[model samples]
Target: MSDSDPVKGKYAAFFRGCPVEAELLLSDIDSERIFDSIADALTETGYIVLPAALPLGISDALFTRIASFEDDVFRPAGVGRAAEFQLNPFVRNDEIRWLSSGDEVEAQYLAWMEKLRVGLNRRLFMGLFDYECHFARYMPGAFYKKHVDAFKGRTNRVLSTVFYLNPNWAVDDGGHLVMYEDSVEPIAKISPLMGTLVVFLSDRFPHEVTTASRLRYSIAGWFRVNTNLGPHIDPPQ
Candidate 1:
């Protein structure tokens, strides 16, 4: 943040004497501006697609981390949750490895997301309790059928986010995320370019990944509200 930053500038006096944790971020990235824009777009259109949104260094580091993983680290992705989870290759052919802060690079990415969660909560007034994410890899010819991340009051997932890590991606790469509304025709087709970020209401749009010509990489995450009450939990142990 700079002396001329609008978010910090506008709230400087209001947040004067506040603890360092109160601030959105201490990173060199323009997080305040980017997060504010995301909040605004989500408010107006329920979704927003940003190209090259992340800082170059962080993006490159994340890409390197996921790319260096061994094949055995990932497991075939499945539908549903916990006991309801089951593999079906027809629905999705990709593999994923859940993210955790134990690793340095993964911790860095999650730290940024934690800041984003706070920013969105402050702006949107939503009870976003936490976030969970995974690295998804679509190998050559792999694809995922259209599906929504959440369904109204049934799921804890409130907002979904996807960050692309494929550097030097081309239009002919053949792996595009297609979003849909009420119409049968798709509304948007997004290329998996490095540093691109996509955010949307988890229940609002049905989306799918097209067949990949080569390896496609991305981080898929969700902001969730706590659903733990007494004997029942959102994710059963």
Candidate 2:
């Protein structure tokens, strides 16, 4: 569409005049390009990792806020949902605190993810209906065994997204996210570096976190379709 087209012109004006959320998204052309790249990568492979995908300031603020949370605020990472949910440290040895719009960084990050959800839907026609995420901390020696985020036709979580929060991370840190294909060999090993974002098809790739020698921090999230089963819902609990 030409810039002079009335509909296109109206959107251009609206982009400039919209609120903070729109301003944060529409004003950053690079982010749009990044989203396109992410979509393309997911289509080509099952996953993609982008370094420095998020604004540095937002990543810093989120890391700081999560670090400040009281010890009790985080619960042992578990598998399953609601009644079936139970702590399974053998599978994953980490702690988690769910994300909410309770703080400035949390709110900003949610807004950012919302913008991403919209962008992905527009580009790929994924019908992503909602998103939910949590702040996760992996203490020394913590690790998660290989697993897929969702079961095909049993869950609505279609896409998984992870944002790392550890700056100055090293290869020795050992908390690399290892993704596997059909074979035993891993296809990708990703470091938990600050501002790095990873996106993937939830049920297509099996992945794990290697044991970390030091504290590891990240935001793990999913974009879900609105599929209902009886009175039960996706996201389980």
Candidate 3:
């Protein structure tokens, strides 16, 4: 509200003195521009990166919440459908816990994602019906092998998203997401920096998480179409 408040909120250097209420910096995103960019990228290369997608306040709060959790709160991430799911550290060594509409910050983030889903659907006619996400933590020396988020003719996951929460990430941090646009080379190598958001076609991009020297945090999610019916569901995962 005050000029001083904005200055203090912007520089978050002294967390002990700055009030939490002052940190709720609402997003000032241009919806039309953002969705248009996303659509264009999807049409061209099948992915897009939106730096500082969420306001610094929301991203900071979400990161704090995830960092405050106990080690047991996250389970070793696995792959495949319900019964077919198995833990194979060689594939992905990170730990994860699905996000739910409980805490205030979590609710706000989910609502924002819903708005994104609706906006993209309207502009790009993506037919996105729902969104799901989980908080993931990769410990030191952990990594995920190159893989696609969705398989052809098998799942309803249409879009994949990754929002990074690690602050002050350095070039040597080693947790870069390398996405392959072609068979022989990568199109992008992204750092898991604070407030960064990456969205890509689930089945189009082949990506992998390189080893991290220190702990890394992020929220990985997907947008899906309604494929469930009376007696059967598309995917039980």
Off by over 4 Å in 3: 1-29, 228-236
Question: Which of the two candidates, 2 or 3, achieves a greater TM-score against the reference?
Answer: 2
Error of 3 at 87 (Å): 0.2
Candidate 3 residue pairs in clash (backbone atoms < 3 Å): none
- Cα lDDT of model 1 overall? 0.84
Residues 134-175, model 1: lDDT tens digits? 999999999999999988888899999999999889999989
Q: Rank the candidates by lDDT, best first.
A: 1, 2, 3
Deviation of model 1 at 171, angstroms: 1.0
* Candidates 2 and 3 compared by lDDT, better number: 2
Candidate lDDT (C-alpha), each: 0.84, 0.84, 0.82
Worst 10 residues of 3 by lDDT: 6-15
TM values, all candidates: 0.86, 0.87, 0.85
For model 2, what is the error of residue 213's alpha carbon versus the real structure, in angstroms, after optimal superposition? 0.5
